[model samples]
Target: MKEEQKHIEALHDIKDMMNRSSRFISLSGLSGISAGLCALAATIYIWPVWLAVREKLRTGGDLQVYPYPATDVQRLLIMTGIVTFLTALLLALLFTWMRSRKTNTSMWGSTAKRLMTNTAIPLIAGGLVTYRLLDLELVGLIAPSCLIFYGLALLNGSKYTVSEIRWLGICEIILGIINLWFIGYGLVAWAIGFGVLHILYGALMWWKYERV
Candidate 1:
């Protein structure tokens, strides 16, 4: 019995070492929750802007959100997106770093580098394409494109992180594709995709891995 137990313990240690080498396992669920809350706040703040846009499209007339001209609506959305993204990114990095410290893991290890490389490529490409879309005045497609690209980023880097992220990526991709059929409901899509999904995923992750 003692020998068999020793063998099992050895196998478990090997598995742990393999996982540590292949993945950045120190990510905290709080990162996702914080990002989600930021997204939801942004969504709430931008709901009025979305309503204004809808009104403008429906009436085919000049519209403005208070002192700004109709043309400024897109600019306003872009600014909001930038702020929310930066804030979320900052919070995510902070939480990740803290978790890495707690776990005594190297936050900037080779696995993390590979993960960032895979994720950043898709994100940078998406940002450029999305910018072009904005310049071309294809605002309706912006939400779906953002969702799809971000999904690709997550999926691309998921091999270097927890497997749950892959499912999140898949869900984001599916939601983006579905949003194509409901362009008028882009805000709704964003709310559910970025806000609700992140919160749910984070909560699940905490329950599964961080509960102790």
Candidate 2:
């Protein structure tokens, strides 16, 4: 019996080593948590501005949500988004690096490169599409579009990381599709997709991986 158990353990270790070599498994849940918090903070700070933008789009004569903001308020809102994204990315990188150190994993590897490439394609396409939407003043679809694309990116990259991310991607896609009907509530949907979903996924991952 002991011999059998030893053989099983060896098999498990071999499997684990193979997984680590092929996948970037050192991603920290704290990264997601920090990102979610940053998104929520940005959402809160920009809520009023979003409200005004929605009102303007609904009533303003031009009815054009240009790539460039027409008002100081709108510009500030844009800045807020940029800042939030940068902050989240910075924190995420920091946390991931910390985890990689703890696990003695290489932060830059073929697996990580593949993950980034897969994730970037969707995000880059989404950015271009979003700009076109703004040019056309189809502001209502922007939030849903972002959610969908981000979810797709997550799905694309999830194969290289934790399995939990795929579920998060699915949830984001579902929420984005549902938000299509609630066009007036783009900000709310954005919060739910980016902020709330991140928090839930992060918490679950932390509980499962980090708590121990």
Candidate 3:
């Protein structure tokens, strides 16, 4: 009996060790839901204000009242960069804290480090190129291009993470194609694709996976 008990304890130990070695533990559904909701709220708050500003520029009579088109594009890019960076940083810190609380392990693991590095490279390169293209007014199919590449990135990295994320990428690609039909609403499409879809995915993930 004692030998059997020892064997059971050893098995448990091995299981625990395996769990510790696994990646993707920081993917908490609750965290996803919270982040998504935050995105949605931010979109709701910002989009109208942005539209109002654009409308003012359109109607202000003074052609020079608005900055140069290039200046406006640069400003938009900078704002987007700041917002994206802050979102990433905030999520990272939140996940790190949560994971530390749950498992006495460092959140900055090889998997997360690799994931961030891999994801950032293509995105940064594509974003810079897209910005230049937009500045040059070569925006005939920029929205679709961005969507396709972003989806590809997500799909490529999905193997290291959750399967749902892969589906999200596919959906993004589809949405991007749809956006081509309404090129005038590119900003709205982007906001919906990223902000709305995130909330929906996060809520579903939380409901199905995280809820006990």
Candidate 4:
């Protein structure tokens, strides 16, 4: 019986080593939480502008949404989005690095590169598409589009990380699709997709992986 138990332990150890080598498992849940918080903050800050934008779009002439006579709201939201994205990215990197150190693993490796490449393709494509949408003033579809693309990116990259991210991706995609039915609530959808979902996923990851 002792010999059998020893063999089982060895198998488990080997399996763990293989997983570590093949996956970048050092991603911290707090990183997701921080990102979600930043998104929520940005959403709150822009809520009034969002209300104004949608209201105007609902009633204003169909020529355009903003910059016709030049307004600060358009620039404000763009700047906020840029800042929010950068802040979330920096925090995510910092948390991942910290976790990697704690786990005694290298943050950068072939697996990480693959993950980044897979995720970046969709994100870059999505960004370009979003730019075009803005250029055409199809503001209603922008939020849903972002959610879908981000979800796709998550799914693409989830192979190199925790399995739960795939579920998060699915949720994002579903939410984005649903948001399409409510075209006037782009910012609201954006907040829920980026802010609420990320926090939920992060909390789940922490509970599942780091609870010990």
Please write out the lDDT profile of model 4 over residues 77-128, one tens digit for every residue. Answer: 7899999999999999999998889988888888788788989999999999
Whole-model Cα lDDT per candidate? Answer: 0.86, 0.84, 0.63, 0.86
Report the lDDT of model 1 for residue 187.
Answer: 84
Against the correct fold, how does model 1 do in TM-score? 0.93
- Clash pairs for candidate 1: none
Candidate topping TM-score: 4
List the lowest-lDDT window of 10 residues for candidate 4: 62-71
Instruction: List, residue by residue over 44-157, the lDDT tens digit for candidate 1.
Output: 999998897786674763222122236677678878988999999899999999889988999999989988999999999999997887666666677888999999999998
What is every candidate's alpha-carbon RMSD to the true fold?
Answer: 3.4, 2.3, 5.8, 2.0
lDDT of 2 by residue, 15-47 (tens): 998889878888889999999999999999888
The pairs that clash in candidate 4 are none
> What TM-score against the true fold does each predicted structure earn?
0.93, 0.92, 0.69, 0.94
Off-target runs (Cα >4 Å) in candidate 4 are 61-71
- State the local distance difference test value for candidate 1: 0.86
Query: How accurate locally is residue 19 in candidate 1, as Cα lDDT from 0 to 100?
Result: 92
Model 3, poorest ten-residue lDDT window?
Answer: 61-70
Model 2 lDDT vs. the true structure?
A: 0.84
